[model samples]
Target: MNQEFIDHIKALIKNKAQSQLKDELQKLHPADIAELLNDLSYTEAKDIYRLLDNEIAADVLVEMDEDIRKDFLELLPSATIAKRFIDHMDTDDAVDLMRDLDTEKQSEILSHIDDVEQAGNIVDLLKYDEHTAGGLMATEMVKVNENLSMPECLKEMRAQAEELDEIHYVYVVDDDDRLQGVFPLKKVITSPSVSKVKHVMKKDPISVKVDTPLDEVAQIIEKYDLVALPVVDSIGRLAGIITVDDVMDEIREQAEKDYQLASGLSQDVETDDNLFKQTKARLPWLLIGMIGGMGNSILIEGFESTLTTEMSYYIPLIGGTGGNVGTQSSALVVQGLANSSLDSKETVKQVSKEAVVALVNATIISMLVYIFNFFRFGPTAIITYSVSLSLFSVVMFASIFGTLVPMTLERLKIDPAIATGPFISITNDIVGMMFYMMLTRLLS
Candidate 1:
């Protein structure tokens, strides 16, 4: 699907040129147009979007990344964006787009949205925190009274068919509008006319509270394999449903955030972000690393006299091998943390695998380092055996710490993201240095 449409559109845009691109974009569905837009130059995309209907434009805008959407909004004048276009969007998307706009611009966009119901919906959706169920759910779910017979349920659902295009399940609610159960569309259509919705509905549907963390919600969704899940208020009244598509987006966003945090950048870092912002986000980490390196320099200075007196030919060789060993251990532990594949049940297995991998690499590299030094310096290289042993011990200990630190942090209610950044690097460096010094002393 990605290749077929994208290639065809590419030929149209690139071969036929800008005028043809604009004309071709008009013929595409909003989602398809969105895909095409993603591939185009920002100026070309803007021009093509102007040629399309506002309703189509709005749909594509919602589908776009926040960067592209913000840029598009900046280009379009308020008058061209119709009330129907804004009204057609889901409340969550509307709120997200609006939140990016300046207060005055947000008000201007809101003023253009004349539909009171849509306006109120966007307002209500904006009230919830972004990580919670209220922020994640779509307001487009189907609801019906519990008293309705299966025939009545079918009739009511059919009556509302025009308004329920995206409906996957129908909710059963009490007179007070509190959710009692949910009935999938298939069940309603297949059940006997005499059977009430109560007889067919799932009494306790999988749901998340409005304030539940996004990660926890994602975990529940994964654990249950739910195509869609309902969101409820503190009072247990159903508000909306979060779809699989939205959950997938949340997962990608979270993964990106983890990457950025691990690299010591802002969670919002993007290719389109300004240079100054990117630098500001990255500067702290570089500075911290520099300071940490300075500490390493100081430690080396303290050991300088010992090194000078020992006059070891194997120092360079040992240093190179130890660095490589420490790096390999750090990489494995980081991978294990990111995958969450290492848990208490498999802790022993993961540690053993890590140890074997680290040990093998350390031994091979250290043996080569010792061999080269022995040939070059004649018996002075015996010190390398001690250096190699120390490096092996450091890597083994570092791997264990790397695995346990995140686990312990999570248990203590700290975000595990902290373990990925300066924390891990600094801790590993300290441990690695200690290993080097201890080995040097024993060898001397």
Candidate 2:
């Protein structure tokens, strides 16, 4: 949010000419207002919102947090709002808003909506789950027939330009409305006037179905460095296009989900989400960890009798090594999987590479510890070797667990990021503690 722009909006709201404020706000882009809306309080945002036309407000509203948006909707009289603003919104944006609305509110809004076509589009979009490609795509796209000449295509585009928002790609379709191919606008413009779209356009355009997952869509866009990707139906008919901007949102949403899941919370946990709801989301993981800890305790208590001698003092050494190695491996594996780069071949390679690196560090560190033990406590070579071996094993185990757990989660269709910190830490702590104590009994 730009502070200067926010200040300008604030000053405008303070002035007497509330009527003129809408015209001034229209000058700013919807993205700018969306940014500013996030920065403002609900009340302050409502004031700024009322000044804008319904279309602008609806666009900005879709970008806002769920709680604040609900509050803003209530602030306005129900009759003053119409479905046209929402009608102007893309299918994805409309679905998001509809999903957040209360059952009664949703029914009321839909009933009041005059445009049957737009309302039906929203309903169609709402059928898909939120994370799917159908839920992310906008139905507003420019499509032209492959048979159209340059002059005919230009005239059609000029007429349709007002209806479409994201116009980076002009899709070439057949009589059946099936996507034949697509090319850059530059190609369309530079081609000879007599060249048919079919002759000029590249066939076999890379495309995705409407039901594809958001992360997969993001991956395709990123991999191809696309400005826009066409969304198609199961039969490969053109559905819509998801612009680069929406892909950016999907990336941010996925990143936030990864962060939340890594901390053992649901993807919906946001700053605006209620405390009790957030607490409930995390409590399950903490309880599971506690259960694991207690189970670990029972096992460790069995070794309480054997920790009576020289080895008791060295227990911490093994635990520390295991914890560090496990954490390092988990981080690498988690990142690899999250970015869709981790596979069995890569995992094997990564595990091998990481194992070598960890072993080298562990060997050097254990040698240093052994040297210190010799000078500080006059330990025998056997005792030093035992400790070194225990530490090395712990390090190796930690690295293996860290690399494998995330990969396993990915195989199960769970996010690999969730395996990074808390899950890694808990497993490492339990394994490290148990292994160190178990090894100590043998070494002693």
Quote each prediction's TM-score: 0.81, 0.87
Model 2 over residues 1-444: C-alpha lDDT tens digits?
668878777777777457666776778788777777877777667777667766777777777767766777765544444543575677777777778767677777777778888778877777777788888788887888999988788777778788866577888999999999985678657999888888888899989998898878988989999988898999989988888888788789778777777777754676656889888878878887788678767767888875555665775666556666776787778777656777744667777887888788778877887787787667764456666666777777788788888877777877778777567767777776676666666766
Residue range 1-444, candidate 1, lDDT tens digits: 377766766676556476777666667778877767777777667656657766677788888778777777776666454363576677767777777677777767777787777777777887788767778777877788888998888788878667654777788888887889988788866888888888888888888888887776777878888888888888888888888888788778887876787667745677767998888888888888788778876776777755643344544443444444444454455455545554534656766776777667666756775676576657655454665676566656665665666656655766566566665666567556666766776677
C-alpha lDDT of all candidate models, in order:
0.70, 0.75
Tell me the lDDT of candidate 1. 0.70
Write down the lDDT that model 2 would get: 0.75
Model 2: per-residue Cα lDDT at residue 205:
94
Query: What does the lDDT read for residue 65 in candidate 2?
Result: 68
Q: Quick one: best TM-score, which candidate?
A: 2
What are the runs in model 1 whose C-alpha is more than 4 Å off?
1-23, 26-32, 35-46, 75-84, 308-382, 411-414
User: How many clashes does each candidate structure show, in the order listed?
Assistant: 0, 0
